[model samples]
Target: MDVSNAFLHGHLEGQVFYQQPTSFIDSAHPDHLTFRSTLSDASLFVYRQGSTTAYLLLYVDDIILTASTADLLRQLTDRLRAEFALKDLGPLHYFLGIEVVRRADGFFLHQRNYAHELLDRAGMLNCKPAATPVDTEAKLSTTDGTLASDASSYRSIVGALQYLTLTRPELQYHSAGVPPYARLT
Candidate 1:
């Protein structure tokens, strides 16, 4: 599911000020709305009422919601719709670069598309997989290569690869050697 115009939903306690956007204003009626900025985990949110529980995972405006029962799921979704301009995407298929496959037993998630995108970004789309990603016996130094010509692009690919860790734990074994905190937030 998704929240439409999520930036407009913030209700602040104190006075907020914003300029009237150029395109929307006539010379006469010049009023504008303001919103508060906030920071959050962008992770999971759990709701519980008696024996019923609902789980909501949030990433920016995108949301993945589930509940203890089908009825609860519908009720929760309806409640959200009332509060916000929520778009019902129906069953989950693809989210956050991960593909969802549903079966009788359970659901499976993978990042094959994300992997391909990463390879393409790194200019390795047609490259074959290496027998080993790195030399087992090789010793590494802090100063290895000079540096990437475009550091931001390098960081972008590394960050995308990091997100893939949700579905590909083995990727954790290989890294860009860039400090984790060094990446753009």
Candidate 2:
């Protein structure tokens, strides 16, 4: 999932400008533009080498890769590193705020770091961690507490939790509930 041309491959409704290329030095018009922009797909790119294959993922400057062979992976990584300024974050531990965990059971994606970030952003970072998420016997109702004056904030927390559920199905009950602060009130 590589963005072909990436920044140069997107549609622009308004004007875009850039300095002339070093190779295309314009002595006649030193300040003149050397390139005109165009629109194309930025979501995907394909590169093939013999029978082995590699996939490049590009989101702006961020990239992830999958390869059919280790040698191919190494070759692709080397080539990419040489061409672009990149950091080799080996083994894909984290991407797009989702944490990747490999276990005997299977691969798991969780927002543990993302969750922590959200909690910190919402000032819940230092809150005590409950032994369990919610009390099984605790009955939840819509009319439980006073309406939050900033409903948007409450909703934002819920939305973050909802995204967390992509890897944390077990937390669905806890994530989708009315705002925890409201519940306390």
The candidate that achieves the highest lDDT relative to the unseen native structure: 1
lDDT of 2 at 165: 67
Model 2: CA > 4 A from native = 1-44, 125-185
Find the candidate with the highest TM-score and give its number.
1
TM-score against truth, every candidate: 0.67, 0.48
What is the lDDT of every predicted structure here?
Answer: 0.71, 0.64
Question: Model 1 Cα displacement at 7 (Å)?
Answer: 3.6
Residue range 1-185, candidate 2, lDDT tens digits: 23345466477888988764435766776753222222353434455666866666566767778789998778777766665656666787777777778889988866666877788867888886554556779888898978977889989887887766654565555444444322221
> Candidate 2's error at 167, in angstroms?
8.0
**Which whole-number lDDT from 0 to 100 does residue 35 have in model 1?**
18
